[model samples]
Target: MKDFLELLQRGARKRISLAELRQHYFSLYPDVQNSPDRSARLLETLRQLETIGALSLPAVGSWEKIGVPPLPQWVLLKREPKAVPRKDFGNVAWAPELGFWPELRPGQLETLLPINEFLLRRRGSLMVVPIKERSLEIYGDEKRLDGMCTGDSLFGGRLHLNTLGCFRVPQPLPYRMADAPGKPVLVVENHNSFWSFGEWNQQARCYSAIVYGSGDAFRLTGRALQQVLGQVAGSGAEYLGDLDPKGVRIPGEFNRSAEVGSPQVSPALVFYQWLLAHGVRRHRAECVSFDAASLERWLGAELAAQVAKVWQSEHWIPQESLGFEQLSAGVL
Candidate 1:
């Protein structure tokens, strides 16, 4: 019965039909197929829940709607809840319907009555507080229903809380470019390769900045890279990755993302030819055919044909093989 209520709460839809419930139940517990009269037992359980006011069955409908009441306050309060000295607990509110509080002080609330009232009023929602415009604060407590309050540490001297500064719930790729360094940003596929370029740049100082592609040129990384490239136009961008199917696909994706007709290649055709001739090969059996169409679409026919030839020969050269010496020498 508790599982049933939990399932309904987790569902996006407010109501569920009997047929859907049976299907979901069987899917969740496949072993139930061996039980005799499984449907009858499930119906009996529903009837029991209806009797206890946990759910309701309409005379004219085939669905059982959730009717569980909000959890009681006593269930939420710690045996002896206590308020922190000189700290404000007024803003935090409890949400009993969700079975937890939001934005609560870590060690506050000595009594249960105040906390209970807070829970009853909010039901199960966090209380919104007035924050400075364009500013965002992170506050959530699954225990008490206090309104909202910002912590001193979060707002202390080092960091300013704002939309731009705040670490949003889901972070995008780590897209960073050095401050107005130079032209032709170097975009490397793997983190190791990006750092390798960083080390090489310290001495060679060829590129304005080095961007990490975070593998496969994820859409977020591509978009962020495109924006960074836009800010520094004439500089353009060069892509470098392993000489394989995925590596070829990444630069192609980047060209589309940056909306460039013909993007520059990294390591130069001469260097690529050298690597194809001398570079070590591993995972030959696992090497799959390259997507010739995507390669052609992004890298142009000349480079695409070169990569396809390498793929056909079952030869792959990782970017690391280029070595710091070759990289620093501006081999590309």
Candidate 2:
């Protein structure tokens, strides 16, 4: 999956040799799934990676056993404090911090990461191309943005590091009311749920909105949840996530480590009803599946039981499958 490859690239520091990856992934895979059936899946994933140019194959073993090319050299060397000449390194990229690489173009450079975005900003608009990666930076000088700080904007520009920046978004100021001053705050686990906060303004007025950009942000986002718990007077607050297991577990894990007296809520049935009403099929991708009823039944019977008993399970569901419309109705 794209998520898994991106995770590899991010943690491996741009590229990792093939041998290193086998050990890493093998360790993470469930022992029960380590047979030929799973190996087939692994090979399929590697082929997908090759098709996307995310993984390179150098006349060798399985495509999975290859090394990613050096991050195109220019990305590392361009970080020098001193300015360099804009010589036509012909066939070379013009990325500011990444310098020039034979394989890169102006459009592709920004997709590297936040640090690269900052570097490219310094490089000016002298024709640069990037690869097929997501970029969050506001490019070009003409279309200025508001309600955004440039320094913070650069931080937010990174697909990975934005975890920290989302934390800095405006927090609801502490308030003293006639009722219990603080109830438990709802921690939304992804950007879509966080964005949906606008539609639930009336409901949200009764609670604080804390955004954790991804399921991966559970630990970091837990800090914000802690802040709300400490500041609020009572523990009437509740947490909500998608109907899937991943959604169920994040808040459950956060509650275990961070808070007290709050309930973990799943709107699986609500989404199931909505899907039936609206006529949508569950889309399948990687670990995320849209079969709300099936997932709901599985979670209620197997996954929840496992969580309640074993305290460890890999069941995860992506909130995006329900679509924003259903999410706005609080069905995530």
Candidate 3:
């Protein structure tokens, strides 16, 4: 039941049908799937919830058209009827989007008092506080709230840490610079490509630097490119990766999310062209969903059309298809 409400709260759609619920939730939780008379029990649970105005069926096969807000309220009453939060909690709130809460402990109310005290102080201002700094100030331990922000665990059942108005500081990307004084830097998604590019740059001196994106690591750390480019005096950056949905998404998202004045990240067009013409293809069943607008935006019309055909065929080209020796031979 808790899982059911949680899924409705976070699912992309505002309302989920019975088929989607069965397909998604049943496959994910074994206990729910294995219950005796599970279908009957699930319908019974929905009927009971409907009677209480906790949720509504709408049609014969739908569940919870209006999500989240009303859900945690019913769940709170059902699970912890004996333990309840006081009405005087002021401007502080448990993030309404979350459809769950932590188990209330003995001194949980007392613990929540100070946590709310910290949150209330930050209520009106745009204070861009560091996550650890905010965590230490609110909770006693500096590392107490690490990895507890999303869907994991709510602290003390009364406070939502995500609403604390704090931001995470991303770490810098790992990179190697060419000894030469050129301004254009190449960003490589895989380590092998970075090594090949780095070795080639050492001799060819074609680029000012080569950045190792470590697959998806560059998404967060790549935000720091304004500072990274400042170090090398870089004009702009070109991104090259495996010709797949995820690889395309990495750079597209990275460039879109970049701060003003950050070095531009474009597809390593020349390298991608080579990969398109000669790169080896690996077939993957799940690589067919690259329908994001970023697909056309990042790769342009012509290249995106080619990549779309590859993705539709359920295949992708690896960056490694362009080897070390060829790169060292000034093959861009």
Candidate 4:
């Protein structure tokens, strides 16, 4: 990382005075105050740089020195790139799953789960679910409240609906790790492997998966995942998307949005390894899993081809096709 002080100085573009230079240096290394000689040495280094013409002296007695280059390109770039905002579900309506209410909110769900928010949208009266919670408070004038909260909705287990309003609650995903009795949970994205891993729960040892319903889920589901991982701390989270380029890129964005670390696996590599062991020289993407095919179809022909090139070059997987029996036998 660039030294923060240096970066700030570059942006200001003004010569620093001697006092300012000393203050800036000491601000970053407070311990330098304890050693006068060390502090003096630092000042000497700066002076030496100026003497050698590595820095510019705008005035006879100014403390601030202009850094010389190949000036870093950072000076040319005015603003840092803005990250795309994550999808948030907050404005969705709320109501009890079965209980009756006098009035209904425009959105259907009351307590938004993290997973639900990733899939939902807000427009007019619709809203994506906010972070996972159990309850919601009824602020009168749902429309007016909507304006304050923007398009995002909140959900907690406890509903403090003091005002007369409705609430909506949807079924939550059941995430269970397959192996250790109380092992850490692992969130898997692949649908088939998600179910298969669940089925092989006893055999796999421990760790469960949360399936990605579709490409759309990657956006909002990250929060839900944080919630899930929070409940199962120490769990090893893994994303099992396709080996294609888009699949690889999505995980990177997902990690940023969730602010969590979850490494992705290459199902194609797994399949490729399996075929190599089984003496199968040739295989198609769909043979390893049709869901992989569906993903390609969804991405469209142009992007799909781009992703294929990436998988073939960087993430070729040959063992993904092997069953658990083969895996356990070390045939892979």
Candidate 5:
């Protein structure tokens, strides 16, 4: 009977049927199925609750909670409620008309229950704001306000934030190189390679810029590659990474983009061939099979076949294995 009252109080629907109540009772006591008088006992409990003005029968089949208010002590207590905690909102205090508590920290609901209930009743909305702004708006405690915001942004040139205000900056992806030096861009995978390539570029004067592929080349550098290639008029791009499944796969994925026009991106075949010649060991255990068909579409038949052979052998060569000295010696 107590369980039935608790269910009615927590339920979103104001009314329930006798059949539903019977199901609820049976669910609570599955063993009661074997007893013949189980239905009679369940009906008696419902009648007892109705007699105590805890529930009411509006129609022949349906029942609803009466206008009985919760004990004042229940509201006054700061401890957890006796009934099961709500799933959506954790522990909560019950009131007559108001539903479950809003998402809040432990003692927060206890201290601010009246204010929260008032806001809900009068405004018909929860007072939602950032944690730092809550005190300033609710209690008029201006001293508690602290200016802080969170998220990521990208810039084409530069930006400066001096005041407490929201700012939206356009991403620098699909980045155009304005008045860039006349040379093809070299995309380097590792940080060491990126720096080494930069130094080599200064001496050899080959690339416009040495872009960093940052490990996951496709996901991290795809948009930037497209932007750089699209913007630079006569300049092409080449990718240099480890001669592994992932490294081989990166260049293939980049060429898959329809937006980036032809003379499509290709792997640095010369550098890879150098690594193989220098006795770069096969990491057969780590190597996984490659899709020859996909590679063939992006890379020519010869390069794709070579990559497939390496993949099948489970052989890999990290770009770092071909030290800066070796890489600098082999010019693109």
Candidate 6:
């Protein structure tokens, strides 16, 4: 590129026509003068010069040497030839229930052919093994399809392994068990709070379990409580969260949104009252609609009144305030 620019400066004028620029460039490299991609290759270098403020196309098919720039070492790369799209691949046949992705890039099926062929050779035999086991059998390496089954990750979401007859067990709901049947579990929102309750409850057997609510995750995973109740008949559940707008809303919203006959969720009223009394109130950068009626309806009028006053005072009591120390003290 430096040689090309220096050649133009020596033999060419301030303003050179495209033909003159090509003549100077070809004269410097006579080998590529007649190459099929000569014009494209030369244009790429010309674009580099134009980018560095050394040249400008003031008029069509004309070049203007704007200024001489201190040359930075520039590497000229030859563009790779575009791959020719395959006219077609041989007919692919998997089980009638399973098929190739609905959408294929110009030549994607050709790359994906071997996997389909392996499935076809199996004679429609479906899954008996776990997803990773099936993945190892098909691809000779496990985890090739891991985490690719969701939201366009697997072949653009055209197929899921489970839908393709490969069994993938869903992860079980995460929880800490107390093994105290027929007792209510306390589902704590924050991890520290869950740990405090989980460790204390293990010895005290105050709850059948101490479940980590995992914040918003509990809204969806609350059904796990049903699985808990199934094993511990006549058991119920209470929830403890930070004394914030979201905390107050979580239980009420979970109950309202859950399907009928879903497990009952109630506030751990005694703990919440204890939190009001002992938990330090801190100002937090939280965004929530301060709905007094919702608070009153969710917490009974008494506690709801205290929580509302806290909100009005612009402070909150996070569940973490009642840590292992407080629970271990057996004060509440």
Identify the candidate with maximal TM-score: 3
lDDT of 6 by residue, 1-332 (tens): 65566666664346655666677677765434544445655777677667665566444323333313212122232222223233444445544433554355423453355557666777557756666776667656565445334421355556655544464443345567776888887888888877788899888888888877777767655457677666655388888998998887787777775655878688899899998999998986452348888888878898888887777777899888888988889888
Question: Where is the poorest 10-residue window by lDDT in model 6?
Answer: 67-76
Q: Which TM-score value belongs to model 2?
A: 0.32
Work out the TM-score per prediction: 0.45, 0.32, 0.60, 0.34, 0.43, 0.50
lDDT ranking of the models: 6, 3, 5, 1, 2, 4
Residue-wise lDDT of candidate 4 within 1-332, one digit each (tens)?
12323433454644444455556555544323334243444545454444434444443333323432112111112233223232333443433432322232212222123213322322134333322221132222223233222113322212222222222222343575443534445444455655554565556564544444244355445545655656655354555454443444565555544433533222333333234346222334443332445445444455455445534543433213444555456553
Candidate 5 residue-wise lDDT, 107-182, digit = tens: 2343245434434444534334443344345435432222211221111111111111213222333222334466
Steric clash count of candidate 4: 56
Decide which is better by lDDT, 1 or 3.
Answer: 3
Stretch of 10 with least lDDT, candidate 3: 72-81
Question: Residue 10 lDDT in model 1?
Answer: 61
lDDT of 2 by residue, 216-312 (tens): 4663344444455566554544444554446554555555544344333333344333433443234333334333344434356544443232222
Q: Number of clashing pairs, model 2?
A: 17
TM-score, structure 3 vs. true: 0.60
Model 2, position 171, has a per-residue lDDT of 30
Of the candidates numbered 1 and 2, which has the greater TM-score value? 1
For candidate 4, the TM-score is 0.34
Across 72-183, the per-residue lDDT of candidate 3 in tens digits comes to 1122112212222234433446534322324432223334555556655656663666777876887665654553443222452334444666655667776788776647
Query: Which regions of candidate 3 deviate over 4 angstroms?
Result: 1-87, 91-130, 144-166, 259-264
**What does the lDDT read for residue 221 in candidate 2?**
45
